[model samples]
Every structure is written in structure tokens, then in C-alpha cells.
Target: MDEIIQEDKKVFLYLNNLGDPSFDQLWMLISSTWIWVPLYIIFLYFLYKNYQLRSLVFILIFLALGATVSDQLANVFKYGVARLRPCHDPSLEHYMRIVKCGGQYGFYSAHASNTFFLASYLGILLKKKIKWFPYAIFVWAIVVSYSRIYLGVHFPIDVLVGAFAGSLLGVIFSVLAQKVINKQKITP
Candidate 1:
């Protein structure tokens, strides 16, 4: 465990150090949830385009629930693991570039979890309707997840675990939502 943690720190440092001051603001913006509102709106538009009003409402409910689950699950892991964010780690202070700092714990990033959750959820929901969308949204999730490392707020392992958990939650929720849709005979 200790050796793996040490490797995590080393990898974190390598990724965090790749940042340049010139791109700090861009990464910080990318890290901000508010900055992605337009993209989220676009996602909503796509959802509306694909599903009927009733089905869309149900899908939206599942989306909200999945995102909440992903975020809360991350919180549980963060507090349970009690791992320190790179920005808040004393040993990493000297070696890392702190473009932005978040809370004390960042074992698994909520941002990564939530974004990946949305990506996986929407990607599944919209895959058939928009053939190219799944790939694009996954890329978006990856970039958003990477922004946490670039900003020195999370380790690579943190983001990786969050992405995995979020993806799993997404698949679960999407399956459940699809069942509801199928049972209701809600045609898109």
C-alpha cells in the first residue's frame, strides 16, 4: 500500500508539473463546474431531441440521481480514505505547482466522478441517436478529469478511481432508466 501510494505521489508530481503558467487560467476554468454550463445545456438539448417529453423527464430524473450518487459516493471514499489532495499535502507543496487548490481531501475527485457519470449516462442514452456523441462526451469527461491533475488538486489515481466508479454508476442507472422506459413503452 505504501509503495503504491508513493508511486501515486510520483505520478501526481509528474502530471502536475506539466502545467505552465500561461495555461493555468485555462485549466482553472476547465476545472470550474460553472464553465461547463453551456455544454450541459447542449446535453439537455440533445436529450430533449431524442426522447419524448415523458421519457425525457424520466431520463432526466435518472441523470440527476446518477450524478448525485457518483458525487456522494466520492465523498464517502474521500472521507473514508482520508487521502490528502496534492495541493494540501505538505510533502508535495515544494514539488507541485498549485494552480488551484480545493478541499483538504481528494482521494477520489467528485468533479471527475460527476463528469464521467454524465458522460456515460448521456453517452448511453444518446448513442443511437447521435452516433458520434459517445466518443465526444467521453473525451470531454477525460479532459475535465485531467484538469484536476493539471491544477494539482487530485492525483492520477484519484481521478482514475472516480472515473471508474462514475462509469459504473452511469451504467447501472442507465440500465434502470432503460427498464423504466421500456416498461412504459415510451418511444423516442
Candidate 2:
């Protein structure tokens, strides 16, 4: 376990140090949640398109619940694992380009988990109607996840596990939401 973790750190340092100063602002923007507001608003359009007002409320509620679950789970892992954020890592401090340090623990990233949760939820919900939706969501998720590393806030493994866990949650919740849709006979 120690050896593997060391290797992971090596890989993380390599990736985290790749960003040039010129692109720091770009990565910073990508790592910020506020920058994604327009994209989220676009999601509102889809929800309105797919369901009547009542069902849209239910779907949005479930989506928010899924995101909440993803965030809480990530927080649990962070505290349980007690891993330091790359920016806060003494060993890694000299080796990486840290634009900004986040919280004390960063075993898994809530940002990655939350974003990927939305990606997975929206992907599954819109796949039937939008053939390219899933791919786009995953791409967006990846970019956002990588931005965490670029900002030196998380290791690659942190984001990877977050993505996987969130993806699983998304699948579970989306399936449940789908069952409800079917029962309600709500067609997109």
C-alpha cells in the first residue's frame, strides 16, 4: 500500500507540475463552480423539455439529492483516509506548481464527485433523446476533474475515485429516477 501510494504521488506531481503560468487562469476558471453556471442553466432547458412541471420538480429533486450524496461520500472518504491535498503536502510542496491550496484533507475531491454525479445523471437521463449527451458529460467531467490537479488541490487518484464513486451513485439514482419516470409514464 505504501509503495503504491508513493507511485501515485510521483504520478500526481508529474501531472500537477505540467501547467504553465500562462494557463493558470484557465485552469482556475475551470476549477471554479461558478464558471459552470451557464452549463447548468442549459440543463434547466432540458428538464423543461422532457417533463411537465410536476415531474420536472421530482427529477430536479432527485438530481440534487444525487449530488448531495456524492459530496457527502467524498467528504467521508477525505476524513477517513486523512490524505493531504497536494498543495498542503509538505513532500510535494516543493515539487508542484500550486496555484491555490484547498482544505486540509483531499483523499477524494467533492468537486470531482459532484460534477461527475451530474454528468452521469444527465447522461443517463438524456442518452435516449441526445445520443451525444453521455460522451459530452464525461468529457466535461474529465476536464473539471483534471483542473483540480492542475490547481494542485488533488492527486489523480483522488479525482479518479471520486469520479468512479460519483458515477456509481449517478447510475443508482438515475435508475431509480427512470423507474419513477416509467411508473409515471413520463416520456421525454
- Candidate with maximal TM-score: 1
Per-prediction count of colliding residue pairs?
0, 0
Stretches of model 1 off by over 4 angstroms after superposition: none
Model 1: colliding residue pairs: none
RMSD after Cα superposition, model 2: 1.2
List CA RMSD, all candidates: 0.8, 1.2
- Kindly list the per-residue Cα lDDT of model 1 for residues 1-188, writing each as its tens digit: 99999999999899889889999999989889898999999999999888999999899999989988999999999999999999999998999999888889998989899988988899999999999999999999999999999999899999999999999999999999999998999887
Candidate 2 ranges beyond 4 A from true positions: none
C-alpha TM-scores of all predictions: 0.98, 0.96
Residue pairs of candidate 2 with colliding backbone atoms = none
Model 2 per-residue lDDT tens digits across residues 1-188: 89888988999988987899999999999999999999999987887886787677768888989988999999999999999998888988778998988999998989889888998988988888778888998999999999999999998889999999899999998988878877888764
